[model samples]
Target: MNRFWPISWQRGGLSLIIAALLVFGTVRLFTNAPEVALILGEPWEDMRQRSSAKIDPAIPGSYWGRVITSDARLRLIDLQYGFVTPRARFFTVSFDDNERVSSIRMSPQIEPLLLDDTLKVVLDLQEQWRKGGWIPIRVNYDPPFADTPEWRAQLRNVNKGGTSYWQAGNKYQVMMVVNRFKDERNPTEERYLIKLQLATPWVSQ
Candidate 1:
């Protein structure tokens, strides 16, 4: 028997070692690489105040004209299918490897309105996008997949809604996700979530 190490002390030391390893492993496992996203319809000042990313003067703060990224021309494909609650006043857009916009998301601060109103808003916004040189490349209704299991189950049990998709472009293409939901209390009433994606342009090295 080794008198230098007691059974109780060994057990205690082993437990501490295990705990440290768990903490270190967890930090290594969950930490993700920091990525950048563009803030559409927001001034550089506002975006700068919100995030640590370097902001460039784009559309004079109304839109992010340019952003400084480590990769320079980074692809923003991940944001296309990603979801974020709309909050605050601006929309964040992500870019692709070719330095083209890939995704756009508005803060959830914007509340959902009636379906009719929502449609009107969509049409109006589309018009603005057109003015920005975006042309419709693709249009569809209802996402091929359900928003979520809960939402899907609700759609089956309560009401069915529309998820209209519109892809437009000129110098760059963009995809829009317009989700509409019917009010449970008043089926006549509705709400919506709108997301946009910039087409990832191919770039040759």
Candidate 2:
């Protein structure tokens, strides 16, 4: 295992399960992956209905629930099994008072063995959105990364990291990044959080 994958960040119990899945490829679990990019302004009820339907009886941790936050209400997804869907691990959807989706976030779990593999998938996914006219906004999250032409030029050498903020035709706000951070509790280990946050006022393409 890479020094990054460890028994930290409350993900310790998963270490063995993830390792086991890696060892016996034939026994792999698979399922339909959720789309990481979200459609802002979607009806909360409709979105909640679709999410609630994805639970698996076989995976006890598989669940979607709602919560109220200081700023907005949210739908949280905790899907524990779906190896076939790559890193489709968890999600959070926040909605406005009108019950329209105000933002959607996808935070996929990445294993050490598949860091590069997963990073490639994420960057490719971002490229697809770029092709659809999702250009980087003027500002972004902190970096050792950029989504500009100069930065994208290094795609061939991308390992598992970047920070990019973007917008599409004045309709949405996006932040896509592969963040690598060390757990203070486990200083020697490194981990990556592959996240995509899409935010907007009520509007749709």
Number of the top-ranking candidate, with lDDT as the measure: 2
What TM-score do all the candidates reach, one by one? 0.37, 0.50
> Can you write out model 2's per-residue Cα lDDT over 60-128, one digit (the tens) per residue?
232222322111112222122111123433444555555555555444443332335445556655565
Clash pairs (backbone) in predicted model 2: none
Q: Which digits, one per residue and each the tens of the lDDT, describe model 1 over residues 8-84? A: 33224333322322221111111222334333323334544454344443342132234233211122222233222
Show model 1 residue runs off by greater than 4 Å: 1-102, 107-109, 139-171, 182-188, 199-205
- Judge candidate 2 against the unseen true structure and give its global Cα lDDT, from 0 to 1: 0.41
Local distance difference test scores for all models: 0.35, 0.41
